[model samples]
Target: MEIKNEYLRDLYRRVEKRDPNEPEFLQAVGEVLQSLAPVADRRPDLIDWGVFERIVEPERMITFRVSWVDDQGKVQVNRGYRVQYNSAIGPYKGGLRLHPSVNASIIKFLGFEQTFKNSLTGLPMGGAKGGSDFDPKGKSDMEIMRFCQSFMTELYRHIGEDTDVPAGDIGVGAREIGYLFGQYKRIRNTFTGVLTGKGLTYGGSLARTEATGYGLLYFLREMLQKMKHEPVAGKTAVISGSGNVAIYACEKSQQLGMKVVAMSDSAGYVYDEKGIDLAVVKQIKEVERGRIKAYAERVPGAVYTEGCKGIWTIPCDVALPCATQNELDLAGAEALVAHGVMAVCEGANMPTTPDAAEFFQKNGVLFAPGKASNAGGVSVSGLEMSQNSMRYSWTFEEVDRKLEEIMKGIFHAAYTAAEEYGCSGDLIAGANIAGFLKVAESMKAQGIAY
Candidate 1:
């Protein structure tokens, strides 16, 4: 990525040299820095204040070893990490992903992206990400419980409601959250909002499970109205992933009169000619914890295909890559462009690669980056934090309405920022600039750390 501003170019080069092996982190840095050239040119004092340089580096990175005993009395070990990227506006807020793929680079990438995503929500939440390489799949409840206890044993020392709050991601969900929260409570001896995505019986807020998916649609609806004066009604949509984000995204899109034709899991994708049956999907995924192929078996007129990436090859008016980062590559973007995709809004962090995102923008696809489009989860997490502070919880309708309003506010913030920066309709740039400026201003106000 070429940054036009001389200062930003130098900073990018320095980051590249410092972390050459971290492709994901470098990719995120490149995207944000490239979009920031315009801001850098206008506010050269940012360079003088070392905001760009400092923001790229995490405030703290903690790595630890997690060891636990399995059901067979076998010892299992995994690595855990938390990258507290930034806390200028507020305490660190992000998700904890547990999977075999967890590593320093991936956590850094996620943490870096979370900084801007939290910022775009217009809430006083900073950014951080923590996770372990412990795979929770196929583990017995007691095994998972023991692992969560061991992981939290070291992690509890670094987190708090006001300092840093970690929620679920990837392999981490409500079940895992229950175990982790139980252990945290046992060790800390007090209940606080140290974690989001808790059970409703506890400090958890309503609408959190549906926040990201519903938030994505809310942002997309706003984008559609602004660009085409339309809604998602009667349109065909393709979404990747069968997790919480994809499942609820299907529900919300269906409720809005859109036909979601396909959804996927890691192993494969299931395509239905008619709109997907949300009830059946919920039963298979949420209830049975089965793979997506089971959806094809249970529902008629649906075909199961190997390889989840093939989901993108199916044509649609809209595409939501709710899966992992870089899932939608340049080829996928080209296919979507070829299929006349009107818009693409990400429901996952950095789901679209840089090349693909630029292709969509150049071809006038009304693209929205994850930072702006997927801030709803964190927005409501912030709401959960607020509720935790007040010892009160809002109703589902109330939280959902607040999330919709915040998504609209984020869209306008990014959109207006893009227009101001002379990059109208380029939400990728708009979001980066909007989020960067807020953090930059805060960093400036705080003065140099050292």
Candidate 2:
């Protein structure tokens, strides 16, 4: 997309020049900048204040080394990163991803998107993201613990309940969060809600586990009703990924009267002509810690493919890419469109490539971006933050109700913003503009020091 506004164009140019090698971060920035031309035209004073320039730059970038001993008693070293992208709204809040693919570019991209995502939630949380290049696969429990301890040794100094509260993402799950929190407590000698996604015995919120998946459907429901004048009932859906997000998303889709026919993991995908059996999926993924291909073996008449991306070829009314970034490319979008997909709501961060998302919107498919739809997980994280501060937790029903309301509010906010800015029904533009306005205005109000 071309930046029609010269000021926004120059800002993007500077970002490109400074981070020439950071494609992911540059793509994120460019997407937001492409949507802000209307805002730039309306608010010339923001341009004068250099808000766009400052927003593109991180407030702080911390990198450290993590050393731990493996089961063989040999030492291993990995690089860790935390990019505190923005704190204009409130404290830095995002997840700590642990994957072999982790790097400065991925962290920065996630953090930049987090800033807007947090804003869309209408929470006081700002944006930040951190993670390590350490791959937790094939490691023993004790080895994972040692790695977590060493990672926190350096990270404990930079994070707190009010400073930055890190949650779980990707490879960082309940087990990882438990390990990370334990190390933080041992090092600090004090227990606080410095981290979300803790175990239920601790301060973790009741509905936090199901928040993202449920929230995606909540947002999708609103988008369908408001844009297409249709309900989610009777819609056949295909969701990519069989992890936490995908599993819960499948559960929620079933609850809402939709048939989720297919799900995938890194190795391959499983397709069931009938609605997916959630119990079997949970057992295979959560309990067994096995590949998705196992799903086909356990469930009779189901077929398993050997490639993850092939999952997109299935026909469905709704498509939720709950996997990783860029998992759904232009080809996937074309396949979905050809199959007459009505909506594409992201369950993972930037799961749909820009071209794929563009194709969806251009084809009159109702597309909800991850920042708005996937805000559910973080919405519950924000709720968990509140519960931690008060030393109180809400019931499962209460938390679920709150999450539904927040998702609905996010949809309307983006919808209204798009209509108000003359890009009616363009949720991509609406979400970017709405989220950017809040943070941009907050930055302008606080001056350039932030």
Task: Give the runs in model 1 whose Cα sits over 4 Å from its true position.
Answer: none
What CA RMSD would you report for each candidate? Answer: 0.9, 0.8
* Whole-model lDDT per candidate: 0.93, 0.94
Minimal lDDT window, size 10, model 1? 1-10
Cα TM-score per model: 0.99, 0.99
In the range 289-353, model 1's lDDT, one tens digit per residue, is 99999999989899999997788889899999999998999999999999989999999999998
Segments of candidate 2 deviating more than 4 angstroms: none
Best by lDDT: 2
Backbone clash pairs for candidate 1 read none
lDDT of 1 at 432: 93
Clashes of each: 0, 0
